[model samples]
Target: MTDPFFLCTLLWFALSIAALARLRRRDRQAIQAQIRQVGQLADETNELILFLDYSAPGFKEIDAFLLTDMPGRVTVVFHAPQWLFAAKAKRWERHCVVSADCLNASSSGMTPTRVVLDKGGKYRVFYEVPAFLKLWSRSKM
Candidate 1:
């Protein structure tokens, strides 16, 4: 009786491991397929894109930037790099200001960017808000 019980337990354990391995492989394939689709969409739209792997070990969301969900795990895409800075500012409860010189330097990848917060006049700014709310408010009286 004891021998039979032990044999059954061992068999069950082995089967569980095998099933887990199969599920992992399937999940990986699904994630890969979704990533390919996202890449295609981004290319078609000609927009700057960023992909965040939430399922990956040691994964951390970027300090700023909004993520759009397509399925398995999560993929994040930003309209522009400047949006990232704006998002960060929003998170920090601060305002984001961009100057032509700083923007040019950062985007051009020609020189190191220096952070300057001085009392100045008008400058470019960016902010984040719920798209639905924005559209809804615009439509309302």
Candidate 2:
């Protein structure tokens, strides 16, 4: 038990465990902050922010929307819906992947911009439809 090799290995293991615990705590706090931001945005907008799968093949929709927007068009950024306050944020973080068809863009007469949060809650992507094409693309979405 007094061997230097065993002592060194035990010390390394203890340090590694401490480092891992610190990293985990940091990650948890970051996730909480992200959730708070999302919740606040959702509350302010009072609109449903559509969540999409960033890893899918059809994720090009956000890119298309970005390209289609006119250079002069104004942009608006809004947050999540009321239901996402705090309790449901965890569920949302766990299960944000959803089909685009879940939303009916035409019912509102205007195509509302789409908001997507990354799975890690580290980034947000917004897809704004152009004013001219709002009606035109309303049926397409």
Best by lDDT: 2
Which residue pairs overlap in candidate 1's backbone?
Answer: none
Return the TM-score for each candidate structure. Answer: 0.34, 0.36
lDDT per residue as tens, model 2, 105-140 = 222322234443344445443444233234434644
Encode model 1's per-residue lDDT on 17-56: one tens digit a residue.
9999997666445434433454454343211223222232
- Whole-model lDDT values for every prediction: 0.34, 0.41
Q: Which candidate tops TM-score?
A: 2
> What are the runs in model 2 whose C-alpha is more than 4 Å off?
44-141
